[model samples]
Target chain A: MKDALLREIGKVVIPFIQIFGIYIILNGHLSPGGGFSGGTILGVSLIMHKLIEEPYKSRIKISERAVMQFTCVSLILYGLLKGYSFITGGGEFELLDIPLGIPGRILSGGMLLPLNVAVGIIVCFTIYTFYTLFDKGEI
Target chain B: MAAAANFPLLIILILFLSSFMMPVLKRVKAVKWLSLSSILLCVVLSVLTLAYVQQNGAFLYKVGHFEAPWGNELKIGYLEAIMSIMFTSIAALITWASFFSADYEIKEKNIMLYYTLCGMLLASLLGILYSNDIFNCFVFIELSSIAACGIVVVKDKKENIKAGVKYLILSSLGSGLVLMGIAFLYSITGNLNIGFIHQELVKVKDLYHNTLIISLGLFTVGLGVKSAMFPVHIWLPDAHTYAPSSSSALLSSLVLKAYILLYIKIIYRVFGIEIVKTLPILEIVLVMGAVGMIFGSILALLQKDLKRMIAYSSVAQIGYIFFGIGLGNILGLMAAIFHIISHALTKSALFLIAGNIIERIHSKEISRLKGIGIEMPITLGVFVVCALSMVGIPLFAGFNSKWNFALAIIDSNRILFIAVLVASSLLNALYYLPIIINAYFGEENTKDRVYMSKEKSLGALLPILILAFAIIYLGISSNGIIDLIAKSVSNL
Candidate 1:
């Protein structure tokens, strides 16, 4: 993978892909792009990195354990947040008591913002971890 | 009572959350204890829930604050209570048993993942039992199938991977068909809730007759494949045989039963039995059951591998349950549900004992097992007790269920099946009895006595003994269980 042309193009392209993915995820509540699609975009950026680097070591230093912990913490946080609402028997607004901010804004969807981020993290980590597992046996 | 009714929701939440917690408990013992205690708590909660349901009548526990028609609901009744208790207890026992031997059976790093999968499997099965919505049921079915596949391949053997992949492809195809079937039902009835769908179907019965027929056909094929019904059972023998022994016990005893329960609930609860009575599907099920019973046992007789033999025997046993369903009588349904309990206990014990033997000798072939029973008398004796039950010997659990099946069909024109049932038992004895004899008597002249072990661990021995005693106790107390099953059937 020492092809200079492809690596140069990838170096230029990956950052833009990631920034757009984050933008889509952050604006998910107000627009069509959301957790799943945006998370997939971010995951593909990692895949692109894996392609450009032969061993995928220097630039990306995340271990399987770190990915696993990130995924687990994000999902459990989601579960606990939902469980809290469930046990308290509160509607979204009543639970947080936060204003649903102007309708088309980033904060309008009450709890959807955090949930979308959690889900995006899960989707992203799961894809990258699956690649690691298939590439080697661990993770 | 109100708090008790929410037990179903609590059971799912606890098990699902514990599965995620397993990776945190990196120590094998910590993970094992966490899984065991959670499942034990689930069993107690299910018992309390069963008592509450039995006394207060069936109730719906809505998820979140939404009303039943608009949101997810857990419907608890006598049948669900009995099934939840059955599923949890068997899981607890199997987990406890495997705790001791899992160190030997699985790689060191994967043991935690194994417990995690077990937890997920339990949650999904319980979800299947408790769900009142068709789409929710579909979601749980998919979850359980993936967890089931994980348990199989977690053993890290080449054969296990092959079996796991084959199981994944076929079961997914089955689930895809099930999704299509659910879509058809939803499109026609405009409802995701089973109760609402049934109510709408009843009103529009005449207009959507053809579409309803197609939906029913799709449900049968879809669930039939998932449950390992006759013709589509090719994946089962390999997957069950190649999985770790405790996994074999769980998959064979409990996982398949969950799908059948959902199928029955869909047929009797959602469609209404009267409408089902008019359809030709029950008769087809009857024919398939009879053929499967004979074919599966005959195939078992041909396998030299102990696990494969037991795996084949499972197909025959499953046939009995389907045949009972096909009988279309109150007594017949009672037999089916009763047999589910009996077979779950008996088969799990058999596989656990088989694991004991396999662990001792390091060979799965039955011929190689001659004389090892002398070294491990208690394990082999448990095997004998379970085998007798499987043979339908009187006073064993299998005998009573088979007797009821006989009695149910005796007055009906399907009396020929009575003969089939009898012949099937004889066929069962032909394959199973020889193994017992070979184990106890055929080892005198063998040179490989070195593989025989003199002692069995308490962990493994305790579960086998408990399940063995449950089998015998269930057999002797068959009258009480019969009455209970009859009451549940009446409720249905």
Candidate 2:
């Protein structure tokens, strides 16, 4: 049970897991996973980081205030867009003049790509922030 | 070519896509921008479709290119467009208002799920509004139930979790019963399309359509439970009270109406008035609606919790909807739809303000909320306006609809229902008026030194302010919205 060169396997495995997390995040709109599913995978990666890289190193990973800021701002921005729709006579989800790209490309599907990316960022950061806050029993 | 009227499908896709994306965007923080954009995009699409539908009148959309006479089809008519207008706009408001009210410990704990449910609820509501196929409507109803349940649970609090579980169980049983009804209807016509079934129902006036009638009865109970109709409305108070603030606003505003709309469609379209004019079951609808109207107000009067009372109040307001539908006049139906918007605006205003009060006072009990009007005068003022709307005070939108609803009842020889409506609105005033009194007029509690956050309530307070003003605006300039609804109803 003495730990030897086997620790190197954990080292190699962490990066592999993170790569897979990124894959899930980027390919979310096209395939099965996206912001939510991928963000969670990456968030789980943070726990692994804390386990192996020492607890103190995790302090710099995210700040609670930033997460709060992100959560509020995202909600506000959503409100503004919806408010605009109510005031206007157009579509509910108002789009820019961007043309709907061909359906097959990664960049296609109108706003879904950007929307997914936004969700991914919110999810990942919020999860990491929650872990940091909760780990210390800090509200 | 009529298959091209499937514009609502794109709206659903947008919501689903955005909801799915919300989880992982922490690094970029761009998801915030994108989510709003998606909603805005939906508004645009709906308006475009509105124009298209108006110019071309009603068109049936056979989904997956299936021809209408045999396979299922989605009906995109004027009635559908007006309903879409109601739901999408209300959804936009709730989504917008969510920005300011919530920022808490479990920031990302279930944020993605929250947005997903919101989107799903919106999509399903729109689907229910537009879909001409009974089975497809059933499918959307199931989606709405699951989404609303998910919204309740998104907070993951013990109370919220329990509430969500109860709703899930009840709603699932309701869905099963609803699906059974759809199956029965399908058996009769050998087709699932509403228009097709409408034609078949007109043809065969002979014997034993009793199964179809029984199926309608089953569908009534199923949808009634979802509507929190009086006797079976056990889960409503707990589920709505425990859900996060935004979700509660949505449940009050749009969720119940979608099912009620189904009841309207079924009675008018599936069975048609040819048989309905003979059956005394229209009396049953009027009776149930009247009971809910009075019972909801009485229950609301006894509740200590702000959200619970609001939930009870919703039960009563739903009674008004069924009342109008049961009145069975174009004017009554128009009034019902108009009341849907008025109630949506007013209830959301009340709830959003309640969220702020909860945030400030950290309690929902009216007794604990002594002299809150002095502390948060602006919010109290907003609530007053919303209350005025709810009670059908002269200048708010509620008066116009209530007046029309009463008129409809009179026109249909159900003049006694008018007494019920008047008594219910008064009873509503009794329950809600006291909260306003306690908040605005009550003497200050001498003991607890609450350090009120002046800045803390801005998020929840502002949007409600806007809606309270909308109640007035719509009341005075209600001609346009009224015209739209009237046109939609007459088309039906």
Identify the candidate with maximal lDDT.
1
Docking class of 1: acceptable
Interface RMSD of each: 3.2, 10.8
Highest-TM-score candidate = 1
Residue by residue across A74-101, what tens digits does model 2's lDDT show?
5444444433332221222343533558
Which lDDT tens digits does candidate 1 get at residues B230-310?
A: 888999999999999999999999999999999889888888878777778888888888889999999999999999999
Across B274-374, the per-residue lDDT of candidate 2 in tens digits comes to: 67766666667778888988998899999989889999999888888877777767788888888888888888878877877787678888888777766
Q: Worst ten-residue run, lDDT, model 1 chain B? A: B443-452
Clashing pairs in 1: none
Error of 2 at B127 (Å): 1.6
Instruction: Identify the leading candidate in terms of DockQ.
Output: 1
Model 1, residue B55: distance off in Å is: 2.5
Docking class of 2: incorrect
Per residue, candidate 1 scores C-alpha lDDT tens digits across A1-139 of: 6677888899999999999999989999998988888898888888778777754455666776688678877877777766555544422224453356788888787777888888899898888778867877765
